[model samples]
Target: MTVANRFLSIDLEKCQGCLSCMMACSLAHEGESNLSRSRIQVFQNPFGRVPDDLKIHYCMQCEEPACMEACPAGVIYADTEKGNVKRIHTEECIGCMACITACPYSAMIWDLENQHPLKCDLCADTPYWNQDRPACVEICPMKAIEVRSEE
Candidate 1:
């Protein structure tokens, strides 16, 4: 099994918790600027810690994805071109919520409108916005997010 050369990386220290990445991701994938549809989420501490309390949450793109195994419909798959990034085949998904339960990090998000689960795919080469990178990384002003490639 070959490891992915390119992967998403985050620097929590630099995150401002503005959620620009979430907005960019939602716009790129869903054609709308809705945070509910975003794959990435920013969690802030209730105590109001400025930079330290912010945490960016998203798929880990596990080497052995539990979501893939737990899916009864076999909609979740690994993207070979992008280093086995776990992705969901939305059309094939049955909205069983198995993937949501299987995700250890609670990264799998439920889409109420689409009746399907959503996870980070590194913005895989889709016709909607076929770029070699993710929208979140591109739109992040603070440069807290990055696409790290093993060269």
Candidate 2:
């Protein structure tokens, strides 16, 4: 498959845990009412503790994805036809946490009630039909996040 250069890049140095990205992301995924169903998970070292600090986590949609390999259900697949967008087939997913464990970045979050893995899809349709970026990139008050060509 041909890899596309499109990606949503986060500049950690510029992020201050404002969580506008999370709010935006959740809203984008789950609509305005439900933030808990959002895909991305933000981590902090607890009270802004040292070493770990704060970071917003989400799928990088890697070229050689470990999460894709780890899933036994084959729920994960690449939209190689659509700019190499990696996506999870919601119907195929069995709520197993295999992909969640496989992710090195700890980007996966388990939806306890729905029993599904949650991660970023990077707003593929919005930017396709309209000239808008992902919601997280749009809502980030710090402007620390960016969506750009990886190349």
TM per candidate: 0.89, 0.83
Please give, for residues 110-138, the per-residue lDDT of candidate 1 as tens digits: 99998999988888754333435589888
Error of 1 at 95 (Å): 1.1
Every candidate's lDDT: 0.82, 0.73
Looking at model 2, residue 114 earns an lDDT score of 69
Clashing pairs for model 1 are none
Q: Which candidate tops TM-score?
A: 1
Clashes of 1: 0
Give the alpha carbon lDDT tens digit for every residue of 1-151 in model 2.
Answer: 4466455678777777766777777667666635566666666677665334976777787878899999999999887655666788877798778998999988778877667888777766543223236887787777877766553
* Candidate with the greatest lDDT versus the true structure: 1
Report how far residue 119 has shifted in candidate 2, in Å. 0.7
Task: Pick out the ten consecutive residues of candidate 2 with the lowest summed lDDT.
Answer: 124-133
